[model samples]
Target: MAIVNATDQTFVTETSTGVTLVDFWAPWCGPCRMIAPVLEEVDQEMGDKVKIVKVNVDENQETASKYGVMSIPTLLVFKDGNVVDKTVGFQPKEALVQLLQQHV
Candidate 1:
């Protein structure tokens, strides 16, 4: 499945079911840019096992703050609406796949 763009208004419902990876990032963040392609590959390869969602920190501050996302490119893995794992900064594709593998 394609990655879904989420906002503060819809973040909860978007991540309420199944395994989800929520990327909290901003356009100005270089690390966030670096991780974009990795996320895309993950979505392509493991779309059936997990759902990916992105929230722009610039436009969705409430959701970011609610999750205590202190930095850009903060990746949170949610299972059935609760956060299960989290990582910060740019992560290699291998690492990303491994991260999602745990929850799937």
Candidate 2:
């Protein structure tokens, strides 16, 4: 899975252009670790159809604050640079895929 590192500078444009899923997480978060593999699986399964990006709350605080992400492992789906869907906490692969399909 290609997990692009999302930052304040790239968040708006990159996610807006096409189907993008930004996974907000921190390195020390347990749920974030649990969901990492699921995200990787999605990246491999979905291929280029959707972009999977990861934002580290510790590193990209500005981006996280902008999106009102108060929890770790927040999944935000963007379509045309606008938030279309959002999910918090660890999710199963199938559920994640379903969310991706909604925006893609």
Candidate 3:
């Protein structure tokens, strides 16, 4: 599954109905680069069980600011449109999967 691009316009609705994992990242963020593959792996492994979305902080500053994303590679897990879990920096694929599983 391809990672969905979540912007300020789509976030509320997209995340509201399902288990959505939103990655708040910037183009220049090294940690975000490191987690890119992990997210892709999760997308494939979890398939439709979860929705993975990427938000480019550079292009979508309003959404990023709304979420109070203070650092790069911030992972926010939303269930039923409400944020339930949050992690900052790079995380291993297993750790991320576990995090997602908790909400799933």
Return the TM-score for each candidate structure. Answer: 0.98, 0.94, 0.96
Between candidates 1 and 2, name the one with more favorable TM-score.
1
lDDT of each: 0.94, 0.89, 0.92
Tell how far residue 53 is off in model 2, in angstroms: 0.7
Which scores greater on lDDT, model 1 or model 2?
A: 1
lDDT (tens digit, per residue) of candidate 1 on 4-103: 9999999999999999999999999999998999999999999998999999999998999999999889999999999999999999989989998988
Best by TM-score: 1
lDDT ranking, best first: 1, 3, 2
Q: Sort the predicted structures by TM-score, highest score first.
A: 1, 3, 2
Report the Cα RMSD per candidate.
0.6, 1.2, 0.8
Give the TM-score comparing model 2 with the true structure, all chains together: 0.94
Candidate 3 TM-score, C-alpha based:
0.96
lDDT score at residue 34, model 3, on the 0-100 scale: 91
Candidate 3 or 2, higher lDDT? 3
Collision count of model 1? 0
